[model samples]
Target: MQEIKLTDVRYRPKYHIAAKSGWLNDPNGLVYFKGYYHVFFQHYPYDAVWGPMHWGHVRSKDLIHWETLPIALAPDQEDGCFSGSAIEYDGKLFLIYTAHYNLKEDGSKSYQEQNLAVSEDGINFTKYQGNPVIKPPLANNTENFRDPKIWSDGQDFYCIIGGQTLDNRGQVLLYKSHDIYHWTFEKVLATSKVSTVQGTMWECPDYFEINGQKVLVVSPQGIEPDGEFYQNHHENGYFVGQEKEGNFIYPQNSFRELDRGHDFYAAQTLLAPDGRRILIAWLDMWEQKYHEQADGWAGMLSFPREITIEDGAVRMRPIRELGKIRRETLLNESTAQGQYTFSSPCVEVQFKAMQDLAFEFTRGFEKLSISYQNGKFLLEKTGYKQRKITWKMETLDVQILSDASSIEIFIENGPVISERFYGEGDLELKFQSTKDVAVKTYRLEL
Candidate 1:
């Protein structure tokens, strides 16, 4: 296969972090250190498909523009370096991740364990000599344990790893460590019964707190569609509750999707310096046809979003630093309703409407239609089922960030939808409404 230049690859994102020439997934080891925000991802550099994973590194002073760094971790005795988290301790950065090893060709026999790596300068990393620090617990399935999320509560460090029981029930295993090395099993933080909506295997678990409520976010596999929710091959959602006596307590029916989109999974969050929980997820889903694979690259990361608990629900808004890339205003109107065309594929659209409204975005042979009527929001795209959500509010406010091949639609007080589309050349946006709607569009220059 011929190597494609990064500048010439079709559908390559301008503002999003994507693999230069291979496969990428699962935002891993997100941390702020030494005046820069570091992002590490699961990457396979040899092909545009899943393989032995390595940690790909990039850093930015502001989250808008990123500079690629050297590959951080590669497979050594282990088969791959899987997803995990990072923490700044004792003036150095420490990464705790899962190491995967396959014992058979068919992968029916495999094992996963937690490992540690330390970096003095936040760029070059050295794996701990005494690796495989924490093995799979006694009652959990070894092959299904991975994606460790580690954090501290000012004293003892806590780590939560995604796992499944031997009986095929999804769960999260908790561990406690005073130092960064030796760890002890704490307890099963949470678990879900084997069902269509809650699958058997849980991956990439993240635990955090907001407004006195603890949130457990996980990606469950083998989810069968439940109406408009759990409609993807895999599902990423969260449960809000309280942690007491090492157990997470929440309503049994409290599971809600983090993003209602066709292509979103393995979300991870970073606690910013100013006390903001920011998140970024893999912008593509499992088993979906990746059109960019033909160009020798496969996946990208969603734009960083600020997470806040509002009205008993988690809300995600694009990071404010993203405004640094705004260049020219394409359209700005107090009361507008009509069709508009723009040559730039990368742009931002914002609007508010009181009455029923419809929007259509078209480019070349691809089109995406969105409508809000009678308190129900509907999204229709080519080659996929329509996604519908109910909005309890009277007014609708939407913000859309469209790049070369990806679109992230954020509805105020509602769920977000992130989708990928393929096309080339000029883009057109049409707005239809019975009454006046305030609209604005800006060209996002990366």
Candidate 2:
């Protein structure tokens, strides 16, 4: 048998973070320690599919170029080291995660408990001697508790763990820790207990504040499809409101989907020192087929996006640091309206359209048709269904970043739609519109 190299994987992304050879999922334990940005993910190294989990490590001085590190946590006395978050305490990096243990009673079901690991050098880590710091509370009877997202307020650490209620409703459990070892359950922060809400299990819950508004992002399972929303098997969305006495005020009226894309879930966000709430998510949805598993790897992370609240809704756009990845200018002009072809999968395109226009990007059979007609913005791909979005604004300005097998479109600094495509050889992009659109294209070095 022969081992597969990364260069042979045609669908592997160039700028996105991916496991070198196996499966990668939910962006986990995202934090900035010392000087570099560390991104840990849910990884299974044995195969290109999900299995006994381990935390795969990678660090980047800049978010564009990444260097792989050793596997951070392996299943020592548990079935897996599931999703969690990281923080820097006393000049040492600490990881708080859910350790899943299978009970030999009938060898059927497993329970979840919160555990801790510490590292001084950020490269080597050891499980804390006092393991299973927090077990499942008596109120919640299910075994679906996991994904602890932690943050601090100058002194004590606050964490949120996704769980299910006794009635099977999706719930977010809040906890407080003084030293990252001892934890006390605070209360249920939020729940999908409404008659209209249908989510059963909440996974990868992220809580943060942006522009004075508190935001809650969660990947909820069993949300039925509603029009163009919740079409995926599971959905990741957020609720924007103000926190009043440990409760969320629904200023936006209801929960809204964060990204209207086919391959986004289990997203996590961390507040940078520079006062930016940046986010990254699992770029492949579980409902979608992973065509690249045959090539020896399965998933990749979405490009880091900055989250903001505007007009009473949560908006996301690519970080400005992504401009550093531009190596050469390919197209730049107000009237730059022609068909451009490229051989590489890494490219960045910026363009503004007025009234009616369409940008058709084709790589063999996979076509990404982006168009704006009569105040309506649309994104269509070959395999997935189209997404039509409408805003109060008249003009549409789009910035697109493309990697080996995925594309992310940012519209007017707000709505971002991401999708996946598989093809070989060259990529062709054709611009056609009723109005002369200003366009700029660059080739990314990463």
Candidate 3:
């Protein structure tokens, strides 16, 4: 089919890489096997929006550069392989996915099953004969048992799958296994309700430990559109708290939104081969109602972020390695314009509007900034041309400055904008009489 990619865009952002075409949802399987980072996602290959589902795959040695691979898993004579995770064992890569085959009489075409597939080369995957390793324990009505994320504790393996009860409450089903093929149902660990914020099913629930604490990340669908809260088609973020065995600390902190900006969901995390908890999220939504679908493409991948718990909550900072995307360096000089350039040349420049000012930047400037407005900080961009999208300073405070790749705007306090741009032309600074400001630009090389 046609591929919906950013091939036409002159510059792709640092960590976000999307498929050429069609719809993309949750990040399927993220794992480090054979020293290469492999990622899979829920994809509809035929169009820019949702169609028949398949697991789209890609890999990277470093998070910045990536190479696309063939589709990993697909629907068979029975059903389609849905969202799940992957792991490595005894030199073999194992993928666990939700297999859906209609079991209802006349088989009304509704069935949700958990299946397994194994791969040694990390490219080809073969389903086990002992498949459908674990069936839904709650009888014929529970059509929601799916998206299993399995892990280990040095001994036996454990898995958490997203599901809903007959009452339609969102929940995570717990299962345990010694061998990867057979999984036994454990008790329900943490159960969320459908009214637990107006969602039908919770998809792609991921649990892992960061440093010393535990993190439970989930994607809840059907949230009523609330400006910054339920911004996505289906929202995927996390709950930071303590989990003792199967239970979690109640009233989980205010369910923090993953990335504050548009284009992020169904995020899956994998402990990198380097011991860092790296993440990748589906750049599209589940609702099939995005404005960008008309552009001949649907979904993308959010910028890969290094997630860490700071101040009792999940605070993400783009990996430092993303700096490698810096194309070429310019304007690494100091200038005192008006009366407030500064006493010293710092890497980060902050400008405030004391009086209306007109600032001028040199032509060699690769990236320029005019942050610190009124009482807040902003990640802004303005070149000599007519292309600019600045983050409102009131919503965002901290951001990164990369040469030509793009600028990341942190809105609603954190994790918002990843507007990609190709700033290869000349750069200039103009502070209108109404907006006085001092500007700083950090140019890069390589």
lDDT of each: 0.88, 0.85, 0.64
Best candidate per TM-score, number?
Answer: 1
lDDT of 1 at 164: 83
Q: What is candidate 3's CA lDDT for residue 249?
A: 62
Candidate 3, residue 387: how far the Cα is off, in Å = 22
Tell me the TM-score of each prediction against the true structure.
0.97, 0.95, 0.76
Summed backbone clashes in each candidate are 0, 0, 12
In model 1, which residue pairs have backbone atoms overlapping below 3 Å? none
Candidate 3 C-alpha error for residue 214, in Å: 1.4
RMSD each, Å = 1.8, 2.1, 7.0
Q: Rank the candidates by lDDT, best first.
A: 1, 2, 3
Structure candidate 2, residue pairs in collision: none
Model 3 C-alpha lDDT per residue in residues 182-209, reported as the tens digit of each score:
7888777666643447466778899988
Q: Whose lDDT is greatest here? A: 1
What's model 3's overall lDDT?
0.64
TM-score of 3: 0.76
Quickly count the clashes in candidate 1: 0
Q: List, residue by residue over 203-272, the lDDT tens digit for candidate 2.
A: 9999998778888888998787776667777888888777998776664327788888788899999878
Badly placed stretches (over 4 Å) of model 2 are: 1-7, 103-108, 195-198, 251-253
